[model samples]
Target chain A: MSDPADPEAAPLSATHPDQPRDFVAPGADRDFAGERLTVDPAGARALLDARLIAAHAAGDTARLVTLYAEAGDSSEAAGDAAAAAFYRTHAYVFALQSGDSRAEELHRWLLREGREE
Target chain B: MTVTDSDLAAVSAPVEQARGLPNACYTDPAHFAREADAVFFASWAGLAFAADAPEPGDVKPVRFLGQPLLLARDREGVLRVFLNVCRHRGMILVEEAARLPRAIRCPYHSWCYELDGRLRTTPHVGGPGTNRHAAIDRAQLGLVEVRSHVWMGVVWVNLDGKAPEFETYAADLRARWAAFDRPLAFAPDGAFELEVACNWKLAVENYCESYHLPWVHPGLNSYSRLEDHYNIEAPGTHSGQGTRAYRPMLAEDGRRFPVIAGLDAQWEEGAEYVALYPNVLLGVHKDHAFAILLCPQGPERTVERIAIGYFDTAVLGEDWAPMRARNAAMWKEVFEEDIFVVEGMQKGRHAGGFDGGRFSPVMDSPTHCFHAWVAERLRQPA
Candidate 1:
């Protein structure tokens, strides 16, 4: 019977070890160099695509922002400016929508690349 | 044909000489549409409960008066109202009640808006990878906001955005119950809805007077007789009945809800039920209060959105669950009892010979006050 409108009635949040993490910090994917994975470039790209699809389906804007940014970074690393801009645009949109501070960084990068007004 | 000024002349007469509003006011679809602008939209009408978007990040999409609206609680916990559409492409936004947590993204084209209704992102607006357009001004393209205010847990909106401030509009009733003015603790389980087969005004008219109580709600006659009630007629604002014999509901274990602090001795057994002008019915007692928003779905249908609240949050705990349930059930039963009469009266409106009927001058002044208010409002130049 607790009033849902009451701020005091909101349930407290606590992290459990067994719970699956739905959030991925921006640029955290770049730290994967320390982990071992014997996948080719195509397999890695497919994996990133799968992760993006899952994040989009879950409506996980934070994850979408991070994954899209990671995709943009990968495209840049491969010297594909057009593809990089496309992925960065997706990241920037998600970042802005989620109110993530990374939107400022993404916007700056897009502006430097002359892809944004 | 619509209910013209001539049709409402009889309703605008003195209480003793007046007939009720004509049948067309209640039975004609065309007249009902006209009332939407003149009677409801032009006045401060109840839109939804503030509880609908209770906490920060909560958002609810509601269709009231056939217009889609979004009710949201911004990050600072302020309740806001906006037209439920994206600034670009005019797509509906926030199709359901849920936590926004960050921003609102239209599913159609992925356009984003901040919880405060600011246009945050318009992806690919300038072309593929470009978001900014020289002609697309984000500041000028935020979600359209409707004029809104929250009082007594009801989110009141003036659709035309021209009504006086809510405090000024409701000044008389606010001053009348100034003592009962305190933080209202919503009884979570105390919310309910009753879809009556009647025009929305019929429900308001039925709630305006208490003359039918002895016969309509016979159960209350034991402790609260017809004579215990008095008319409250505020000419152009509101009208209702006040009962001096109101008794607080008690649980089987004899527990009673806490009374609002600093109330005068009169509220101990006194309570007032008011139909605040167009669409909201309100009641305040020493222990608790209730609000009912009469949402007009069409000419002959109304959904009575009811919510009850107590003086404080004490009734929200597990210890007070039983008492809260008992109190909610008691009011629900009382409200249900009145449904048939309003619906029957709605059906009676179709009777060709019925000339809006007559009122008992001694007992129906509150109802007459409401009828006159509606007639005068409808007669105004649109």
Candidate 2:
């Protein structure tokens, strides 16, 4: 398996190889400019936790989809199937609600992992 | 039922011979419980206004008749009703009025549901972070939807789901008022509520006739006299009084609200107010209309909510604010004046010797009409 915390680890569709592979990379702690920050993966997750709270408080469903999906990808790269499924479930729900097209991708990922029916 | 069979027989008698509902029907909790099941649950009852959940994603939780119910407008803008309890642990879902950008997330366990009541996900039903479980069938568990129908801004619910469709049930009332069925624009400031210490039925009885107008609403009687009104009774459906002397409120600048287009000559100077049995009271005029939803808080308390709307959408503009405020205030004062009478009647119910009083055959037919309707509903086989 690839290094879980490596910035170039596989894309979120690695579990379902038939899907698009140009998606955002899992476990990649990068800033908004696509520059990899030197922050530890745990530190990066804590930052996401704060961002998630702000996003929810603002009722920003679009941002919620992106953040939860990124959290799921990071968990997936770490081989934490349960955590990955949990975050992906949220991503799927928010995406479905906001009419975001990414819901299709998140649902397929959850289905491939045997987490969603 | 706390009401005696003999008491109901007198209430069900002809208008000339009938007496009002028994005192126990209003003063006894056990009778209120029976009335809740027979009159409210078994028939279509007004629960809230569609305006309460006007936007898509708007959710309003209502505690009605001891049942926690939720009113939600789905993503498609269709309003729906559900038992507010969660399908998992029976927790209350939406605790207050809110506009959800996405799904309804249960605060206790993070169970998510789509805006249309589909159970979307259970966060960790199978153990730490695992969502799926063989025992939890998402398909079998959506919010319990109550049968609801929206008409003329009022959201009517059939709690027991045994009543006929709203259109069929209200056909007589609908056909009678078909002329004013054009687009109705709600007044931006024409909503107010009053809490009175009286049984909900008293409010309905009071609103049914013009007989009390000269004494209770002298201001309204100054222009719309009692002689200018006539009885409106559709027996098992609705009953009230219609005034042939309705005059619209005028602004300080002599401007009056725009008249409804294509009205018949009869409505040019006329208006009608009817108690839509069970809980909704409505009044329609040439230029404006109002709906009053009577919410029974307890056997001895009721909440009366009133909202007015206009025939022209221009009334919703900022320039119309002052005129709208004046209109709302006029109705508010008249409704407030009736508070003493209803509360007085409620106190009268505790008089152990009062035999429900007698109806003035000429002037009290509308009130008697309502009493007969209640009696017939209660007499239905349980």
Candidate 3:
């Protein structure tokens, strides 16, 4: 289903926990149970951003880290490099909070951008 | 770097007592990167043909030596090459070859640039639909331009922007073939590409001499004898061989293409093959001409972009398809014949005993001339 909050973002593919799908995380999460699944990636930003907000509200650090990373990649691919870097910063924080191994990966990226000491 | 000053110095030494450039010259990534600066970027490297963007508003994205380049034609009908990177966030502006309507709009932020490469508008740079910004300098943020020149239907780019003018750099070859200083149209079925499992220099070395004609190209020797070939060695400019007994590559029906006007009596029976250093191999005859653009993929790989053109633009139409096909096939066969030998030479370069190998003092002068030219260029400080 489209994220009602940010209607301007690209449409994103939905994820169903029980449904086996392609490896497109940092995109859509396995926990998502969207009402209408999609293949179009035009307003994916709003949908993923909504997902990230919901994960944060639910205190789901694991989901937040992955969602934040996915948002960064989509933003980068869409040519909004500033937004991509911003999302990456959020991903790095959640990665540390969740004790995810991706924290190390994100840390290296932060180092590259001189974001982390 | 695997290539040292001593190895390159061997190029100018006495041929019988000298060694070819070390195998690392063709195998090491670092050495290749070094040449990318001193040789390829500093010289007039082939990028595209004017035929690729014949009309206004045509855009082609090109990657040369791993640098993104976008070729565009403006409304005024002037062709230009740009860095292909957007100024705001360094996004790739154009990723494909297509004709644009008026402007190049960035896919990410929707920032647009005019056909002439001016920063036209920023859809939402200020805010949502607000285009102005006190900090952003529109004029200075225009697309970075690249130094480019066109000659004989081929586009050449000097990334460093320090090389002499194309006319000055190519004066000797231009003066030699001045009769062919006319316009050329690319034949419709005249373009094709080949992937070779060999370093680019191997192809150049293989092309600079005709010593392998009798052995490797037995079919070519049937009509053109080994004795009929002579060397073209204009040091620092270009080097290759010329065939004295050249015959038109006619169709089976024996129809001949229109000859280029004002050709000297020599061209009536002569054809010259020259490697205009860095990466273009050219062939000139009385009726038609062709150029091979070499794209080096890695230490042991290369992609050849071949295009055949004619003095008569009519040769690009339907009636000339058969003749163009015949010419393409003939050249394709000849180029294919050298794949094994060139690939074999690339493999041999890995052997510890291959100390850049030796040059035959008599039959290898043109090839030596090429090596010497490359060494001289690389010898310059980057």
Candidate 4:
């Protein structure tokens, strides 16, 4: 997947089909830039998005955290601060699940808006 | 087989004239079901010991009164109880006790909850890796917290959320034993449980009065004579017996554990036992106190969770461990000794013609008081 022009867009490491998040079509991982990720031969990117939606619907917090973090970028790129904060807050939940630095970014963002609970 | 109006009428009479509760109150399925809600749920029941979840992020799941409950300590080190069922799919959440680092994650769906019971994450609810949906409101749903209070080293819960404040329900007994009002740190050694083959009510009845002590606990009778004990009755609250000759466990070197400060000279060798109505047996002494949280598993099974606490936590260092062990062993023996009679009384309740038996006006006042309290609570509109 090609990285988005906006510096604020989510990191594209996992966006590539070769990344671990995608196990559907091993070699096609690099084809997932935006919509092509959806319209590919197997629509791996689209399937991944759909799977993420399904996971959220099923109350899968582990999957939801990354999905929400990714959603924050889209919401921010679309100029929806409230929506971005909400998605970031949701991602921050999974961030708290680990001691790693992933949650720090979400924490700082939410903390700036006085939304850190 | 539920409690009929006639059953309620039997325990309503004055102590001198009243009979004990009928067999149906203890044996009937209908009455037990009613009690699951009205008696046990509506009233303040002793649920667990505070020491069970002593630190922040410690989560313990408790199945109380047939309801799944979670005892959790939050990030800020505050402890609270919540319904263990998840709000999303009604799944049972924390099933075991562990030090949960950040949040309680539901195994069925990974719906995460803050230690304080807030529903913090709903994962993919929005759409493909989307955790947002306009209809999904995080504020609208969180884990349901059960009403609870910690007192005297025990955790007490009001399932129906209508019982009076703990201070109000226990004011009388607290005032009577005001001398031992200081903080009580439970000694680790003095913890044990007894599974009694008797109805829960039978255990409570046996504990409320000292009328059977001379016969049931002959060892205790040697030092604490029957006449040295008096009945303690607080209508609608607590009732039991008190003794002036409380025996303290002495080490081989003739050393006794430190006594609680501010205890009156009268407490030099005195102790009191009180049955906090519904289901909790409490004992207070000059140096230590105990709460026996009776878990009523069924009509004929009661598990006594007993914990003994000292006046101060600092007093429980390794040096006092031996004394604590002796104290625990002594109490365990005393409690085990009373088992037969309580189980026997439960067996006797099954007799076809036992008309709720009768109470000895002179010696059974405390038991009668408990009967009255249970009768009064059971009679209320459910």
Least accurate 10 contiguous residues by lDDT in model 4 chain B: B123-132
Candidate 4 matches the true fold with a TM-score of 0.82
lDDT of 4 by residue, A7-92 (tens): 54435223422233433332233443423333353354466568678876875655666666656655665667777777676677
> Each candidate: what lDDT?
0.83, 0.85, 0.79, 0.79
Give the per-residue lDDT of model 3 (tens digit) for A1-117: 123476655422223232223225434433344444454575555666677688879877667666777776677667776676566666655554344566566556545654443
Ranking by TM-score: 1, 2, 4, 3
After superposition, candidate 4 runs with Cα above 4 Å error: A1-94, A98-101, A104-117
lDDT of 2 by residue, B224-273 (tens): 89999998998887999999999988999999988977789999999999
User: In candidate 3, which residue ranges exceed 4 Å CA deviation?
Assistant: A1-117
lDDT by residue (B1-382, candidate 4, tens digit) is 5667777888889877798888987777777788888788888889999899998889999998789999999888888999998888999998789887687877775677889988877655654334546776778788998889888888889999998898898889889988877789887788899999888888888998888899878887779999999999899989999999998878999988788876787798789999997899999988889999999888888899999999867668998888888889988998998899888888887897887988999899988888888888888997
List, residue by residue over B194-272, the lDDT tens digit for candidate 3. 9998889999999989999999999988789999999999999799999988889776778899997777789999999
Give candidate 3's chain B TM-score.
0.97
Task: State candidate 2's DockQ.
Answer: 0.37
Which regions of candidate 2 are displaced past 4 Å? A1-68, A93-102, B126-130, B133-135
Worst 10 residues of 1 chain B by lDDT: B1-10
**DockQ of candidate 1 relative to the true structure:** 0.35
On TM-score, the stronger of 3 and 4 is 4
Model 1 bad stretches (over 4 Å): A1-43, A98-101, A111-117
Cα-lDDT of candidate 1? 0.83
Candidates 1 and 4 compared: the better one by lDDT is 1
What docking class should model 3 receive? incorrect
Q: True-contact fraction for model 3?
A: 0.00
